[model samples]
Target: MDKKKVSSWLESELKGYTLKSSQDDFVNFLIKQADKIDKEDHLLLKDLAIDWINSEQKDLTTWGMTIAVEYNIQEATPSIEKLLGKVKEGKLWTLYYLWYIDGFLKRIKEKKE
Candidate 1:
Protein backbone atom coordinates (compact mmCIF):
# COMPACT_ATOMS: atom_id res chain seq x y z
CA MET A 1 0.00 0.00 0.00
CA ASP A 2 1.27 3.43 -0.93
CA LYS A 3 0.93 5.45 2.23
CA LYS A 4 1.32 8.65 0.32
CA LYS A 5 -1.32 7.65 -2.18
CA VAL A 6 -3.82 6.70 0.47
CA SER A 7 -3.00 9.80 2.41
CA SER A 8 -3.51 11.94 -0.63
CA TRP A 9 -6.79 10.31 -1.52
CA LEU A 10 -8.04 10.62 2.05
CA GLU A 11 -7.09 14.27 2.30
CA SER A 12 -8.34 15.16 -1.14
CA GLU A 13 -11.52 13.14 -1.10
CA LEU A 14 -12.61 13.82 2.44
CA LYS A 15 -10.79 17.12 2.91
CA GLY A 16 -9.84 15.85 6.37
CA TYR A 17 -13.38 16.48 7.46
CA THR A 18 -16.10 14.00 8.28
CA LEU A 19 -19.42 15.38 7.23
CA LYS A 20 -22.48 13.72 8.73
CA SER A 21 -23.90 12.66 5.36
CA SER A 22 -20.66 11.26 3.97
CA GLN A 23 -19.35 9.78 7.20
CA ASP A 24 -20.93 6.35 6.78
CA ASP A 25 -20.11 6.33 3.08
CA PHE A 26 -16.39 6.79 3.61
CA VAL A 27 -16.22 4.21 6.40
CA ASN A 28 -18.17 1.72 4.29
CA PHE A 29 -15.99 2.42 1.27
CA LEU A 30 -12.88 1.73 3.31
CA ILE A 31 -14.35 -1.47 4.75
CA LYS A 32 -14.96 -2.66 1.19
CA GLN A 33 -11.31 -2.16 0.31
CA ALA A 34 -10.21 -5.32 2.06
CA ASP A 35 -7.99 -6.13 -0.89
CA LYS A 36 -5.88 -3.11 -0.06
CA ILE A 37 -5.22 -4.17 3.49
CA ASP A 38 -2.13 -6.12 4.51
CA LYS A 39 0.26 -6.32 7.41
CA GLU A 40 1.86 -3.02 6.52
CA ASP A 41 -1.53 -1.47 5.97
CA HIS A 42 -2.65 -2.69 9.35
CA LEU A 43 0.38 -1.22 11.05
CA LEU A 44 -0.02 2.04 9.19
CA LEU A 45 -3.67 2.16 10.08
CA LYS A 46 -2.90 1.42 13.73
CA ASP A 47 -0.44 4.27 13.90
CA LEU A 48 -2.71 6.67 12.03
CA ALA A 49 -5.75 5.66 14.04
CA ILE A 50 -3.92 6.20 17.31
CA ASP A 51 -2.71 9.57 16.13
CA TRP A 52 -6.23 10.56 15.17
CA ILE A 53 -7.54 9.42 18.50
CA ASN A 54 -4.97 11.52 20.27
CA SER A 55 -5.87 14.57 18.25
CA GLU A 56 -8.18 17.21 19.67
CA GLN A 57 -10.26 17.45 16.52
CA LYS A 58 -13.53 15.57 16.80
CA ASP A 59 -13.65 14.59 13.15
CA LEU A 60 -10.13 13.21 13.21
CA THR A 61 -10.99 11.23 16.29
CA THR A 62 -14.11 9.86 14.64
CA TRP A 63 -12.15 8.80 11.58
CA GLY A 64 -9.61 7.17 13.85
CA MET A 65 -12.17 5.17 15.81
CA THR A 66 -14.06 4.31 12.65
CA ILE A 67 -10.97 2.84 11.08
CA ALA A 68 -10.10 1.01 14.25
CA VAL A 69 -13.56 -0.48 14.49
CA GLU A 70 -13.84 -1.45 10.83
CA TYR A 71 -10.36 -2.93 10.62
CA ASN A 72 -10.57 -4.75 13.96
CA ILE A 73 -7.66 -2.75 15.27
CA GLN A 74 -8.08 -3.50 18.93
CA GLU A 75 -4.76 -1.81 19.57
CA ALA A 76 -6.50 1.52 19.66
CA THR A 77 -8.76 0.48 22.50
CA PRO A 78 -6.36 1.66 25.15
CA SER A 79 -6.00 5.04 23.54
CA ILE A 80 -9.75 5.38 23.27
CA GLU A 81 -10.06 4.50 26.93
CA LYS A 82 -7.43 7.05 27.78
CA LEU A 83 -9.15 9.69 25.70
CA LEU A 84 -12.39 9.00 27.49
CA GLY A 85 -10.71 9.85 30.76
CA LYS A 86 -8.44 12.64 29.61
CA VAL A 87 -10.68 14.71 27.38
CA LYS A 88 -13.97 16.53 27.68
CA GLU A 89 -15.31 15.28 24.35
CA GLY A 90 -14.77 11.74 25.53
CA LYS A 91 -18.21 11.64 27.05
CA LEU A 92 -19.84 12.05 23.70
CA TRP A 93 -19.19 9.82 20.68
CA THR A 94 -16.07 8.52 22.33
CA LEU A 95 -18.24 6.52 24.64
CA TYR A 96 -19.95 4.81 21.74
CA TYR A 97 -16.61 4.12 20.05
CA LEU A 98 -15.31 2.44 23.17
CA TRP A 99 -18.49 0.44 23.54
CA TYR A 100 -18.37 -0.66 19.92
CA ILE A 101 -14.71 -1.63 20.18
CA ASP A 102 -15.22 -3.58 23.37
CA GLY A 103 -18.28 -5.29 21.97
CA PHE A 104 -16.54 -6.11 18.73
CA LEU A 105 -13.56 -7.60 20.51
CA LYS A 106 -15.79 -9.63 22.77
CA ARG A 107 -17.64 -11.01 19.80
CA ILE A 108 -14.37 -11.96 18.17
CA LYS A 109 -13.34 -13.77 21.31
CA GLU A 110 -16.69 -15.50 21.52
CA LYS A 111 -16.46 -16.71 17.97
CA LYS A 112 -13.04 -18.15 18.64
CA GLU A 113 -14.20 -19.98 21.71
Candidate 2:
Protein backbone atom coordinates (compact mmCIF):
# COMPACT_ATOMS: atom_id res chain seq x y z
CA MET A 1 0.00 0.00 0.00
CA ASP A 2 1.01 3.59 -0.57
CA LYS A 3 1.94 4.59 2.99
CA LYS A 4 2.37 8.25 2.11
CA LYS A 5 -0.98 8.43 0.43
CA VAL A 6 -2.58 6.67 3.34
CA SER A 7 -0.90 9.01 5.78
CA SER A 8 -2.03 12.04 3.84
CA TRP A 9 -5.50 10.64 3.66
CA LEU A 10 -5.48 10.16 7.43
CA GLU A 11 -4.22 13.67 8.01
CA SER A 12 -7.04 15.07 5.94
CA GLU A 13 -9.65 12.89 7.54
CA LEU A 14 -8.43 13.70 11.04
CA LYS A 15 -8.61 17.48 10.34
CA GLY A 16 -6.20 18.73 12.99
CA TYR A 17 -2.49 18.11 12.55
CA THR A 18 -1.05 17.70 9.08
CA LEU A 19 0.38 14.21 8.76
CA LYS A 20 3.68 13.65 6.98
CA SER A 21 5.34 10.40 7.86
CA SER A 22 5.60 6.74 7.10
CA GLN A 23 2.49 4.62 7.44
CA ASP A 24 3.50 3.22 10.83
CA ASP A 25 4.43 6.62 12.12
CA PHE A 26 1.31 8.06 10.63
CA VAL A 27 -0.75 5.47 12.41
CA ASN A 28 0.84 6.38 15.72
CA PHE A 29 0.38 10.04 14.90
CA LEU A 30 -3.28 9.53 14.24
CA ILE A 31 -3.69 7.75 17.55
CA LYS A 32 -1.95 10.50 19.41
CA GLN A 33 -3.85 13.16 17.52
CA ALA A 34 -7.14 11.68 18.52
CA ASP A 35 -6.31 12.59 22.11
CA LYS A 36 -6.12 16.22 21.10
CA ILE A 37 -9.58 16.43 19.66
CA ASP A 38 -12.19 18.18 21.76
CA LYS A 39 -15.08 16.07 22.97
CA GLU A 40 -17.38 18.13 20.73
CA ASP A 41 -15.71 16.65 17.65
CA HIS A 42 -17.54 13.34 17.69
CA LEU A 43 -16.91 13.10 13.96
CA LEU A 44 -13.23 12.63 14.68
CA LEU A 45 -14.07 9.68 16.88
CA LYS A 46 -15.90 8.02 14.01
CA ASP A 47 -13.03 8.82 11.71
CA LEU A 48 -10.73 7.10 14.19
CA ALA A 49 -12.99 4.06 14.13
CA ILE A 50 -12.72 3.85 10.36
CA ASP A 51 -9.04 4.64 10.14
CA TRP A 52 -7.79 2.55 13.03
CA ILE A 53 -10.23 -0.32 13.46
CA ASN A 54 -10.65 -0.88 9.75
CA SER A 55 -7.03 -0.25 8.88
CA GLU A 56 -5.31 -2.82 6.68
CA GLN A 57 -2.52 -3.07 9.22
CA LYS A 58 -3.45 -5.67 11.77
CA ASP A 59 -1.35 -3.85 14.32
CA LEU A 60 -3.64 -0.88 13.92
CA THR A 61 -6.50 -2.87 15.31
CA THR A 62 -4.78 -3.06 18.69
CA TRP A 63 -3.71 0.53 18.37
CA GLY A 64 -7.29 1.42 17.64
CA MET A 65 -8.38 -0.30 20.81
CA THR A 66 -5.60 1.44 22.71
CA ILE A 67 -6.69 4.81 21.42
CA ALA A 68 -10.30 4.01 22.11
CA VAL A 69 -9.37 3.13 25.66
CA GLU A 70 -7.42 6.32 26.15
CA TYR A 71 -9.79 8.71 24.40
CA ASN A 72 -13.19 7.10 24.77
CA ILE A 73 -13.42 4.58 27.54
CA GLN A 74 -16.91 3.48 26.51
CA GLU A 75 -15.52 2.51 23.13
CA ALA A 76 -13.35 -0.12 24.79
CA THR A 77 -16.34 -2.43 25.03
CA PRO A 78 -17.22 -2.16 21.38
CA SER A 79 -13.59 -2.47 20.42
CA ILE A 80 -13.38 -5.75 22.30
CA GLU A 81 -16.57 -6.85 20.60
CA LYS A 82 -15.05 -6.12 17.22
CA LEU A 83 -11.88 -7.97 18.14
CA LEU A 84 -13.89 -10.88 19.50
CA GLY A 85 -15.69 -11.14 16.20
CA LYS A 86 -12.35 -11.44 14.47
CA VAL A 87 -11.00 -13.92 17.02
CA LYS A 88 -14.08 -16.12 16.88
CA GLU A 89 -13.80 -16.37 13.11
CA GLY A 90 -10.09 -17.30 13.45
CA LYS A 91 -8.90 -14.26 11.56
CA LEU A 92 -7.25 -12.67 14.56
CA TRP A 93 -3.68 -11.51 14.04
CA THR A 94 -0.97 -13.70 15.50
CA LEU A 95 0.92 -10.73 16.83
CA TYR A 96 -2.15 -9.38 18.58
CA TYR A 97 -3.30 -12.59 20.16
CA LEU A 98 -2.44 -11.59 23.70
CA TRP A 99 -3.89 -8.15 23.31
CA TYR A 100 -7.18 -9.62 22.25
CA ILE A 101 -7.18 -12.09 25.09
CA ASP A 102 -6.41 -9.42 27.62
CA GLY A 103 -9.19 -7.26 26.27
CA PHE A 104 -11.63 -10.10 26.65
CA LEU A 105 -10.47 -10.78 30.18
CA LYS A 106 -10.78 -7.10 30.91
CA ARG A 107 -14.36 -7.10 29.74
CA ILE A 108 -15.19 -10.06 31.91
CA LYS A 109 -13.47 -8.52 34.88
CA GLU A 110 -15.41 -5.33 34.38
CA LYS A 111 -18.64 -7.29 34.40
CA LYS A 112 -17.79 -8.88 37.74
CA GLU A 113 -16.71 -5.53 39.18
Candidate 3:
Protein backbone atom coordinates (compact mmCIF):
# COMPACT_ATOMS: atom_id res chain seq x y z
CA MET A 1 0.00 0.00 0.00
CA ASP A 2 3.01 2.20 0.32
CA LYS A 3 1.73 4.00 3.38
CA LYS A 4 4.87 6.12 3.45
CA LYS A 5 4.18 7.43 -0.01
CA VAL A 6 0.61 8.25 0.87
CA SER A 7 1.65 9.97 4.07
CA SER A 8 4.33 11.97 2.32
CA TRP A 9 1.97 13.04 -0.43
CA LEU A 10 -0.68 14.06 2.08
CA GLU A 11 1.78 16.01 4.21
CA SER A 12 3.05 17.89 1.21
CA GLU A 13 -0.34 18.56 -0.25
CA LEU A 14 -1.82 19.78 3.01
CA LYS A 15 0.93 22.22 3.81
CA GLY A 16 -0.02 25.89 3.89
CA TYR A 17 -3.66 25.13 3.14
CA THR A 18 -5.70 28.29 2.97
CA LEU A 19 -9.09 27.53 1.50
CA LYS A 20 -11.42 24.74 0.43
CA SER A 21 -10.58 25.40 -3.18
CA SER A 22 -7.09 24.12 -2.49
CA GLN A 23 -8.53 20.85 -1.26
CA ASP A 24 -9.98 19.79 -4.58
CA ASP A 25 -6.60 18.79 -5.94
CA PHE A 26 -5.64 17.04 -2.76
CA VAL A 27 -8.85 15.06 -2.71
CA ASN A 28 -8.40 13.90 -6.28
CA PHE A 29 -4.84 12.91 -5.57
CA LEU A 30 -5.85 10.88 -2.54
CA ILE A 31 -8.51 9.06 -4.54
CA LYS A 32 -5.94 8.03 -7.07
CA GLN A 33 -3.66 6.81 -4.34
CA ALA A 34 -6.47 4.80 -2.84
CA ASP A 35 -7.08 3.17 -6.19
CA LYS A 36 -3.48 2.01 -6.36
CA ILE A 37 -3.44 0.56 -2.88
CA ASP A 38 -4.56 -2.98 -2.08
CA LYS A 39 -8.21 -3.54 -1.22
CA GLU A 40 -7.07 -4.89 2.13
CA ASP A 41 -5.94 -1.37 2.90
CA HIS A 42 -9.54 -0.25 3.25
CA LEU A 43 -9.09 -0.16 7.00
CA LEU A 44 -6.23 2.29 6.62
CA LEU A 45 -8.31 4.52 4.39
CA LYS A 46 -11.22 4.26 6.81
CA ASP A 47 -9.00 5.39 9.66
CA LEU A 48 -7.75 8.27 7.58
CA ALA A 49 -11.32 9.33 6.88
CA ILE A 50 -12.24 9.20 10.54
CA ASP A 51 -9.17 11.23 11.46
CA TRP A 52 -10.00 13.90 8.88
CA ILE A 53 -13.59 14.11 10.04
CA ASN A 54 -12.48 14.44 13.65
CA SER A 55 -10.01 17.11 12.65
CA GLU A 56 -13.00 19.35 11.89
CA GLN A 57 -11.57 20.65 8.64
CA LYS A 58 -14.68 21.03 6.52
CA ASP A 59 -12.96 20.35 3.23
CA LEU A 60 -11.08 17.40 4.63
CA THR A 61 -14.32 16.08 6.00
CA THR A 62 -15.71 16.07 2.46
CA TRP A 63 -12.55 14.41 1.24
CA GLY A 64 -13.04 11.69 3.83
CA MET A 65 -16.44 10.87 2.40
CA THR A 66 -14.92 10.88 -1.05
CA ILE A 67 -12.42 8.27 0.13
CA ALA A 68 -15.18 6.19 1.63
CA VAL A 69 -17.06 6.31 -1.67
CA GLU A 70 -14.06 5.62 -3.84
CA TYR A 71 -12.85 2.67 -1.79
CA ASN A 72 -16.32 1.37 -0.90
CA ILE A 73 -15.26 1.24 2.71
CA GLN A 74 -18.30 -0.45 4.17
CA GLU A 75 -17.08 0.05 7.72
CA ALA A 76 -17.73 3.76 7.44
CA THR A 77 -21.21 3.37 6.04
CA PRO A 78 -22.93 2.83 9.37
CA SER A 79 -21.31 5.89 10.92
CA ILE A 80 -22.13 8.03 7.91
CA GLU A 81 -25.69 6.75 7.86
CA LYS A 82 -26.10 7.50 11.54
CA LEU A 83 -24.82 10.99 11.01
CA LEU A 84 -27.19 11.47 8.11
CA GLY A 85 -30.06 10.39 10.33
CA LYS A 86 -28.99 12.88 12.94
CA VAL A 87 -28.86 15.61 10.36
CA LYS A 88 -32.31 14.71 9.15
CA GLU A 89 -33.62 14.71 12.73
CA GLY A 90 -32.29 18.23 13.25
CA LYS A 91 -29.73 17.09 15.77
CA LEU A 92 -26.88 18.38 13.64
CA TRP A 93 -26.38 21.77 12.05
CA THR A 94 -24.03 20.74 9.23
CA LEU A 95 -26.66 20.17 6.60
CA TYR A 96 -24.36 20.49 3.62
CA TYR A 97 -21.79 18.09 5.03
CA LEU A 98 -24.39 15.49 5.84
CA TRP A 99 -25.98 15.92 2.45
CA TYR A 100 -22.66 15.34 0.75
CA ILE A 101 -22.08 12.16 2.73
CA ASP A 102 -25.59 10.97 1.93
CA GLY A 103 -25.01 11.63 -1.73
CA PHE A 104 -21.73 9.74 -1.60
CA LEU A 105 -23.48 6.76 -0.03
CA LYS A 106 -26.08 6.81 -2.81
CA ARG A 107 -23.35 6.98 -5.41
CA ILE A 108 -21.61 3.98 -3.87
CA LYS A 109 -24.82 2.01 -3.94
CA GLU A 110 -25.45 2.95 -7.53
CA LYS A 111 -21.98 1.88 -8.53
CA LYS A 112 -22.69 -1.59 -7.21
CA GLU A 113 -25.40 -1.91 -9.82
Q: Write the per-residue lDDT of candidate 3 for residues 1-113, one digit (tens) a residue.
A: 55556645654565544444766776766666555443557666677765654444566656666777776666666656766777777776567667676787787676656
Sorting all predicted structures by TM-score, with the top scorer first, yields 3, 1, 2
Clash counts for all predictions: 0, 0, 0
Q: Which number leads on TM-score?
A: 3
lDDT of each: 0.60, 0.56, 0.63
Alpha-carbon RMSD, each predicted model? 5.0, 7.4, 4.4
- Candidate 2 — which residues are off by over 4 angstroms? 1-32, 73-76, 95-101, 104-113
Compare the candidates by lDDT and give the number of the best one. Answer: 3
* Pick by TM-score: 1 or 2, better one: 1
The digit string of per-residue lDDT tens for model 1 on 1-105 reads: 666566556545545445537757767655544325444477766777677777746766666666676666767777776665554456555455555545544
- Give the per-residue lDDT of model 2 (tens digit) for 50-81: 46665636555555555555455454465566
Q: What is candidate 2's local distance difference test score?
A: 0.56
> How good is model 3 by TM-score?
0.60
